[model samples]
Target: MAGPGWAPPRLDGFILTERLGSGTYATVYKAYGKKDTREVVAVKCVSKKSLNKASVENLLTEIEILKAIRHPHIVELKDFQWDNDNIYLIMEFCAGGDLSRFIRTRRILPEKVARIFLQQLASALQFLNGRNISHLDLKPQNILLSSLEKPHLKLAEALFGQPPFASKSFTELEEKIRSNRVIELPTRPQLSRNCRDLLQRLLERDPDKRISFKDFFGHPFVDLEHMPSGRSLEQATALVVEAVKKDQEGNFSAALSLYCKALDYFVPALHYEVDARRKEAIKAKVGQYVSRAEELKALVNSSNRALLQQGTCARDLLKEMARDKPRLIAALEVASMAMAKEEEGQDDGDALDLYQQSLGELLLLLAAEPTGRRRELLHAEIQTLMGRAEYLKEQIKMKETRWEAESMDKDGLSESVRSSCTLQ
Candidate 1:
């Protein structure tokens, strides 16, 4: 809605429609190209009178940044126009609006949904960091969603409700920021250990202690390696090709690992694909891949059991050899616990975590140990633990895929039944 005397600025090619939003210096309008009404955009009109020296410099910097950067998750700056009274910035229009409103509508997001958003945001941040650019004004309101039905994060934002710190006034907020107070994470919605760990690292009050962009990108919870991107399809295709080759070579373990890694990209690629036909084709291919992966999983599991049995004697020897070294012994104990958990046939995710922890410790020990039999034994133990972790990861992914498929099928059946009842 426009004010009593206000009107949208007339641009040469765009027909400005309803007001989208407003700030101190600019008002945004939903607009469409006069030549092609189907082509929609957002026009930010900044009044000439509102331009201070600092703001004008900021506007120039923004224009340059937008022009030089091109990323799928980033909004595009189509063009800019100016008149005596106002300056108009023609930008990509996001139909889904900002993430703040999105989260407000949903109240709380599921952990999976939150992780997807975090991954997208982390991907964008990684790009910006590479270019030595910082998004200083990051908030949920600044992060836009791509669409209503299939939302993709287009910018930075808070994942959950409210800021980690709540203050009643600007002074209070300033004090809190300056005080370097610890951030208290809410416990209402139980989160996974990795998720909590990431939050804690991210919210560290001391700048020196806060998680760096590299660590954030590599964090287990973020898992940016598997995040969907424009290159996801290409990457998945490449990996699957290698996977098939390995499968044909009778390298079941190698093939299974490759297949699991490929699916890490393939699932994301499936979500990234928009064409209905292509999506269906990918879905079909994924089903085939999954079937083969399941077969490979069984084969690999059998082989791993044998390897573990053979390694048991070596492991016992290493434990006895490391008895004098408490740290090495402790790592071996953790590895044993991980093996026990894996054999229990429950909580593959927990087993994977334990295996990772043990490997971390053993690898550190290996790095410092002198060049000797103990070092070699530690190396072997680390390799064994890594293999176990990889296998557990594959098992967890397969179970997740199965659960997702079942959920989708149940939803379809429910919809069909509802339609039948409506017809009756």
Candidate 2:
């Protein structure tokens, strides 16, 4: 609500355009700078009276944070003005809208396209982490895509709030409001698969261990081997854009492969920097490890479906980790069991194989973290896996023994010789 004498500012030459959006605390408008040359921006108008002491601090903090940071992935603040009760913050606009709407219209994006989004979000996280800032809210709604369709997202329009809309039906209007139609250019192959997990980790509930840009760039998942195409980062980005078109048309596997290739190219560029910078390196390294841990934790949290479908890379990586720490191995074993159950019927052979592998990993872990009640639980679980493995092994042995017996009978050997062969 507007406080008394809260009319929007009247810059001498600047033209006040249409209203962009109105939130509980502020109203945003589209405006153009007249005397300073034609520059368009979204002006967020906040009433000082509406802000309590803490709110005032938050507003100032937002301004401070936005002004200090400059990155391709982050929204840029152009200018700010304080007049009477109204404080206006002019920011860059994003015509393509936010990610929430884009996902709604497109439904499920191809894994590759999702990967590109993941990488961009990762980049943003990396940049923020370097500055020791945390983006508390990181849902799809906060992320916007560039509208390259009309004009390449200009610096002015690629980073601001939206314009207001006429009232409409609840459901339709909700979708429209929520839908930013943000275009997610697909990632090249090597990056496509791992980027989502990365962004997800950044969005963790715990601020103590949020995914930072430095950590994301430092990750093995973002390196050269993960890219889908091109010899360089720019070229890989181009390939990702190209892959988006293919993805829109439902060519996902092709799109994913391309994204993976792009990741391969983008990762190496950051490695040397990470290796050389030791001052912040420890914090950055722990951040990466924590993010990775969160990703696996999420998979375990969501259900075994993700792990079962994503394959052994997720489990295998965890296994390598567990080899050094028995407690972690125990947790991974439990995760493997849950995932194995989900894999049942979908691919029995694969499920069984995963189960065996998980059991092997757990057995090794149990060797170290065999503490009281936990040790007993692990022992029980191990017995179950061992039983299943033994059954499978016996089945194979029985088949082999039967085949040999059949062969001997077919040869019509003497009864005594046949019996001897059969007994063995």
Candidate 3:
């Protein structure tokens, strides 16, 4: 049904059922094609009377941009038409409403779920960035979900509504915006350290100090390497081909790295694959890859132990050479502690943190060190620490995946038991 005193537009080849939403200049409605297929879509109808010169230009620019781009995470602009009274934009219909509604209903999302959404958003942003475009009014409301059961994000136009801020007056909102006050995140729903770090960087008031798109894309939390996308399968296949080549060459270490990278994409590819037969095939391939990777992991671990033993003298020499540089020595000590922690096999998370800290310090020192033996040693140390950190991340993800699968199985069994008891 339309709003009071508002009649739905009569567009050819379609029948508007009900008003879905409306903004200042336009109204969106649920509609279906008049043909037998009866394909559904959302039609955004903008009145000519409401358009000022600036607004008209903005509309034209939006249409041009939407028409020119096509991405998996972006809502598709099917077509457009205009009559004397209104212009219509036919868009892909999303059944799951918007993220704002999804979040509100759930109260607070689990960190895993939030991370998935963030990755999807980042993927969309990465695409726009490649084309030198920006979404000026990005918000939860402007992000649509494909379906409620298994939501896939779709970036869409903003629907005018009450802002998230709780200022009582326009003057108050203006003061809040102008003020140099720090934005504090809520503590009620405790967030993970990576999530908190990303949020803080994103909310940084100074544009110069804020995280850049490149850094954001590469962030550990974003983990674009494992982000599900249309290209996930293609990327996984290419990496696997190289991984197999390296494996056959007996380059176990390099093969292990490539296999890990491929698995990152393969996991996402499995998630993206819809057809049951294809999904099962991917699962089988993944199992084979995983088995080979485990073998390589053991071989790599043995090689690493040998390398560590051989490097002991070199490490001692490097420390003696860097005695004049106390900060560099301290960073080296931290890196050693990270290695010891990893060897102990007690806390990979803590080991990863120490590795990150040492790497951060060593990278800075290396940048300042002149090209020499000391610089070479420092760069090698950084690379080793980075590799360890990446390995730990993969281990963590595998554990998390196993736990989630077990949890789902338990949930299904419990539901089945409940249903059987009810029937009895």
Query: How high is the lDDT of residue 359 in model 1?
Result: 88
TM-score for each prediction? 0.85, 0.44, 0.80
Ten-residue region with minimum lDDT total, candidate 3? 415-424
After TM-score superposition, what is the CA distance of residue 41 in candidate 3 from its true location, in Å? Answer: 2.1
Model 1 gets an lDDT of 0.76
For 65-132, candidate 3 gives per-residue lDDT tens digits of 99998876788898999999999999988877887776666555556555656677787788999999
* Residue ranges of candidate 1 with Cα displaced over 4 Å: 3-5, 36-38, 154-159, 171-184, 276-278, 404-424
True-structure RMSD, every candidate? 6.1, 22.3, 6.8
User: Highest lDDT: which candidate?
Assistant: 1
Question: Model 2 over residues 1-424: C-alpha lDDT tens digits?
Answer: 3567655567544666666567779987767888656877768889898999999999999998888777666777978888887888878766656665555554444332333344455556666776787878755656665542311111101112222222466787677556656323234222322444554454454556776655667764443233322234455457657656655675543444444443333332221122335313422432342343334333433443442345455446545644766666665665566455543535434545666777767777679764665566556656755654543333333232233323322332111110000000
Query: What local lDDT does model 2 show for residue 104?
Result: 56
Error of 1 at 230 (Å): 4.7
Q: How far is candidate 2 from the true structure (C-alpha RMSD, Å)?
A: 22.3
Ranking by TM-score: 1, 3, 2
For candidate 2, the 10 contiguous residues with the lowest summed lDDT are 415-424
